[model samples]
Target: LHLPAPTDPLLRALHDILRTDPADNRSLDDHGRRIGASARTLSRRLRDDLGLTYPQWRTQIRLHHALILLADGTPVTTVAHHCGWSSASTFIDVFRRTFGHTPGTRPTT
Candidate 1:
């Protein structure tokens, strides 16, 4: 995803929310409300600014958090829960797709 820098107020706010709380699984509607935009407008702005839809962007950010948790020796189940995955299986599937390996293959530090 070719994301633009967080220059817009809405983008900056969204970045802050994602950075401070990757566990936040708010829908596009909820996020738009926080930024004073309709979901449609929010979608356009996100695509224009970030080159991805809300859900796609959220997944990317959540996976980033998942990686950090995994690197810190957190259990996969706990990491899945913390990252707001519906189930460990789902989390593993996403992790595998993104990283080309299952969470169990993560190197212990």
Candidate 2:
């Protein structure tokens, strides 16, 4: 999705949180609170600035982290837990959807 250029402070803080620790396990609400905004405002800012829900952005970051960990030979369960996924199955599902195969299998796409 093409996003509007944003100079919103909340958006900037969200970007920093995502960038600082792609694997930060904090929930969206916690992240928003850390930056002194309401969750609703944070969500709206993300949608406005990045054309994505906060969860969507966080999931993308998690998938990237998963791929990196897989490439580094980290166990799948370990990676899932580290990335704050509720379970390995959720991680596998997201990995398959994102990479078109299971984690640790070299992505052909």
- Per-candidate Cα RMSD to the true structure, in Å, reads 3.0, 3.3
| Model 2: worst 10 consecutive residues (lDDT sum) | 1-10
Q: What is residue 104's positional error in candidate 2, in angstroms?
A: 2.7
| Candidate with maximal TM-score | 1
**What is the C-alpha local distance difference test score of candidate 2?**
0.77
Off by over 4 Å in 1: 1-5, 106-109
| TM-scores of all candidate predictions against the true structure | 0.86, 0.77
**Candidate 2 has what TM-score?**
0.77
Segments of candidate 2 deviating more than 4 angstroms: 1-8, 19-25
Per-residue accuracy of model 1 over 11-87 as CA lDDT, tens digit each? 77887788678888888788879978888987888888778888888888788888788889999999999988889
Error in Å for residue 60 of model 1 = 0.6
What overall lDDT goes with each candidate model?
Answer: 0.81, 0.77
Worst 10 residues of 1 by lDDT: 1-10
- For lDDT, the strongest prediction is 1
